[model samples]
Target chain A: MVMSCRDRVLAAINQETLDRPPVAVFTTCDTIGMMKASGASWPEAHSDPQKMATLGCAQADYFGLESVRAGFCLTEEAEALGCPIDMGTSHSSPMLKGHRNKYDPMKKIYDEPNDLPDIDVFLNTKRVKTTIEAMKIMKKTHGEKYCVVGGNTGPFTLCGHLLNTENLVYSVWTDPKEAQKWVAAIAPYCKAFGQALLDAGADIVQMSEPSASTDILAPSDFPIQSGQFVKHALGDLTGHTILHICGDSAPIIPFMFDTGVTGISVEEKVPPEKAVKIANKRGALVGNVGCAMPLYKGTPQEVAKAARASRDAGFNVISAGCGVPIGTPDDNIRALVKAITG
Target chain B: MNDKKLLKELADSVVACDPNRARIASEEALKEGIDPVEAINKGLVIGMGVIGNDYAEHKIYLPQVLVAAHSMYEGLNVLLPAIPKGDLSDAKTAITAVVQGDVHDIGKNIVKTMLTAGGYIVNDLGKDVTPSSIANTAKETSVNVVCLSTLMTPTMDSMQEAVKLINDNGYHKNCIITIGGPPTSEKFAKEIGADHRDDDAQSCVKYVNSKMKKEVK
Candidate 1:
C-alpha cells in the first residue's frame, strides 16, 4: 500500500523503515511565495486561523513538503506573556520590540517571574489562541494528507523573551540559581502551550531554543539551563516532539536528545555527516540544510544539492536548518522537494 | 595595594567576571594616582582581550563573555570619568547596529564590547536600526569602522542596504564596513560591499585595527 504524506512523516518520526524519508520543514517556513500561493499573508495570517491554516498548508499544497506547520514566527508566546511586539510586514517576521520585565544584570536587578498569566489564560491569549485554532484548522483541512506540525518557543528562549535575553545570559554566570528560577517558572507555560497545540490536533510539537544553543550557553550548562526544563515542557507532551537549537549545535546534540524528544532539528552549521555521526540514530533527525546559503541565496541546483546531501547523510526528514528566510525563492523550495521526492 | 598590584587586580577581576572586584580595583588604582588611561588600556582591555580570544577559540561562551564585559564596564565606570576628556580624542571610533527588521542584538553587543575593549570610541545604534540612521551616524561621527549585524536571513538585505547607504553618503571613504551575525557570510559581505565579515568579535576588531593602520600609512 502507498503511504500517505501524513503517514510518511509519522513513520519518519517513529524511525520506521521507508523507501525515502519525508521532506518537511518543522521550523517556520512561511515565505512570501507561500503567502502568495495560499492568498494568506503575514500580520493577518499570523492572527486569523483560516488564513494561518491555509498558509501553513501551502508547503504541502504548493511545494510538496510532507508536513504542514505554523504559526510562522516565535513571537506568539512572548507576546502572550506580555512582551511588546512589532507585527512585521508580509516580507518580515514578527520581532520582539522590548522585554516585559526589567532584567538588568549590570545593575543586578530583575523583576520576579511571579506574576505570569495563568496557564489557561496564556493559552487563550490572542495569537496563542489563534495558533491553537490554526492547528485545529490544519488538521481538519489537511489532516488526512499531511502531518500537522505545531511550532513553539522553547522554555529558555521564552524566559529570555520575557526578561531581556542578554541580561538572563549574564545571570547564568553571575547567579545561575536565579537564572534557573526564571526558566523554571516559565517552563510550565511552555508545557501548557505545547500540550494545547497537541490537544488541538498537531501531530508534532517542534520547540526552538536558539538562546540555549552552544553559541549562548556553555555545552556543560545545557542540561541544567534548558534541557531538563525542555524535557518537562516538550518531552512530556503526548505527541511527537522535535527540539531545534540554532548555531553550530554539534556540541549539544546529545543534551538536546537527552530532553527525550522524538527527534532534533539542527541547523546547517553542523556538517550533515558530522550531525549524523553525532546523533548516532538516537531518534529521528529532521534537518541540516543551510537555510540562508543554498535555500535563500543560491540557485535551484544548489538547493537540490544541499537537499540531496542531507538525504544522503541519512536525515529522517530533510528540512531547513532553521526558519526559512521569508524571501526564499519559489524555485529553491520546489527544488528541495523535488530533490527528495524524486 | 601598589599600582602594579592594583592594575593586575583590575585585569584579573574582568577575567574572573567579578564586577565588584573590578570596581574595587579601579578605586584603588585611582587612589594610587595611576593614570586612568593606562589602567584601562593595560588592565581592563587586557582582561577583555583574553575573554574575547577565548570566545573566538570556543574555550568560553556568551555568558562568560557577557559577565566579562560587565566587569570591564564596571572598571571603566570608575576609571573613565577620571581621564581628561581630550585624552581619548585620537582613539579610533566605530558604530555598531542590528539592521532594520531584526532585533537580535547579542552578537552586535559582543562586537560593541570588543570594539570598546579594543580602545575604540564606539557609538552603538542599538537594535532595529534603520540603514539611513546607520549611514547618518557614520557620517556624523566620522567613525573608522561601521559594524552591522542581524541573526535572521531576511534582514541580510538590510545589512546590504546599510552598506550601500554608508557608501552612498561617501562615508565609505572614511570608514571600513564590517558585518557579523550567524546568517552573514564573507561571500555575502563581499557581495554587499562590506570590508570584512567575521564570526567572532575579537577577529572583527583586529580586522578594523589592521585596516585603520593601513589607512594611517
Candidate 2:
C-alpha cells in the first residue's frame, strides 16, 4: 500500500519503519518556476493567503515533494511585532527594514518587557493572519495526500529579528540573562502562533533558529541560547516539531535533541553519515542538500546525484539543508523528487 | 608610555572586548605623542585581526566578533580625527555595498569593518544599494576598488549588473571589482568579470592591501 505524505513524514519523525524514506523541503522552496506556475510570487504572495497557498502548493503539486510549507520568509514575526517591512519583488522575500523605535527597538523591549506588543496585536498583523489562512488552504486542498508543514522563527532568531541581529548576538555575551529574558518573553507568542498553525491543519511545525547555529553561537552555549529557548517556544504544540539550524550543527546535535523536538534538520555542513550516527541516538534526521551550490549553480543531474548520495548516507527525510534558493531551477527540484522516488 | 607597550595594551583592550579600556589606551597613546595611524594599524587592527582569525576558525562566534568590532570602533573614534588629513591622503579608497534587492548586510558589514580596520578609506553604501549608485559612488570617490556582497542567489544578477555598470562608468580599468558572500565563489567572480571573491573578511583585506602596495610601488 502506498503511504500518504502525511503518514510517511510522521513515521519518519517517530522513527518508525517506513514504506520508503520521506522527501521534503522544510523551509522555503518556492522557486521562480513555482512562482510562474502559480501566477503568484513574492511581495503579493507574502500578503495574500490565496497566492501564498497557490505558490506553496506548487512544490508538492508540481514537483512531487512530499511536504508543503507556506510563509516563504522569516519576516512574519518581526513584521507582526512592529518592525517596518520592505515588501520585496517577485525574486526576493520581504525583509524587515527598521523597527518602530529607530534608535533602539530592542532596548525598548528590554526596558518594558510587560509593554511588548500584545498577543492580540501580533495575531492581527497582516502577514500572520494570511500565513494562517494559507496553511488552512493547504490543509483543505492537500490534507490527505501530503504533509502540510508550517513554521515560525524560533525564540532566539525571533528575538534577533525584533532587536537587531548584531545587538542580539552581542547581548548573548555581554548580557546573557537579559538576552535570555528577551527571548523568553516572546516564547509564549511563538507557541501561540505555532498552535495556530496546527489549528489551521499543519501536520508538523518547524522552528528555524538559523541565528543559533554553531557558525553564530558557540556550541557550548547552544543549550541555553538555543535549546532551552526552543523548548520554551515550542513545547506546547500538539503536532510533531522539527528544528532547523542553518549551518553545520554536528557539535550541538545532541543538545538539539534535548529540546524535545521530534526531528532535527541540518545543512550540508554536517556530513550525512555523521548526522545519521548522531540521530541514531537522538531522533529523526533530515537534509544535507546544498541549496545554493549545486541546486542553484549546477545542473539537474548534479541535484539528482546529490539526492542519491544524501539518501544513501542515511538522511531520514531527504531535503535541502537550507531553504531552496529562490533561483533554484524547477528541473533540479523535479530531479530531487525523482531520485528519491526511483 | 613606551610606544610598543601602549600599542600592546590597545590591542589587548580590543581582544578583551572592553571599549572603556580601548578608549583609555587610545587616550594614553595620543598623550604620549604616538603616531595615531601607527597606533591604529598596530594596535586596533591587530585586535580585530585576532578576532577575524578566531571567527574564520570557528573558535569565536558572532557575539564575540560583534563585541570585538564594537571595541575597535571605540578606539578608532578617538584616533581617526586626530590624524592630519594630508598624512593619509594617499590611503587607498574602496567602495562597498550590498547588491540591489538583497537586504542581508551582516556579511557586508563585517567586510566593511575589516576594510576600515585595515586602513582603507571605505565608502559603505549600506543595504539594498543599486548598481548605478555603486558605480556612481566609485566614479565620484575615485576609488581604487569596489566590493559587492549578496547573500541570496536570486540577487546575484545585481552583482553582475554592478560590475557592468562600473565598466560602463569607465572605472573598471582602474577599480578592482570583487564579490563576497556564502553563495559567491571564485568561479562566479570570474564569470562575472570580477577581480576576486573570498568568503572571509581577512582575505578581502589581504587582497586589497596587496593591490594597494603594488599600486604604490
Question: What does the lDDT come to for candidate 1?
Answer: 0.92
Q: Per-residue error at A112 for model 1, in Å?
A: 2.4
Clashing pairs in 2: none
| Residue A294, model 1: Cα distance from true site in angstroms | 1.0
Cα lDDT tens digits for candidate 2, B1-217:
6999999999999899887899899999999999999989999999999998888888888788878888898899999999999988888788889998887787888888899888888889998898899999888878988889997777788898999888887888787887998778898898888989997888898887887667632
Error of 1 at B34 (Å): 1.3
Q: What would the TM-scores of all predictions be? A: 0.98, 0.95
Global lDDT of each candidate: 0.92, 0.84
DockQ of model 2, rounded to 2 decimals: 0.70
Give the TM-score (vs. native) of candidate 2.
0.95
CAPRI grade, predicted model 2: medium
Where is the poorest 10-residue window by lDDT in model 1 chain A? A104-113
For A184-271, candidate 1 gives per-residue lDDT tens digits of: 9999999999999999999999999999999999999999999999999999888999999999999999898999999999999999
Tens-digit lDDT track of model 1 for B158-189: 99999999889887988889999988889989
Residue A117 error, candidate 2, Å: 2.8
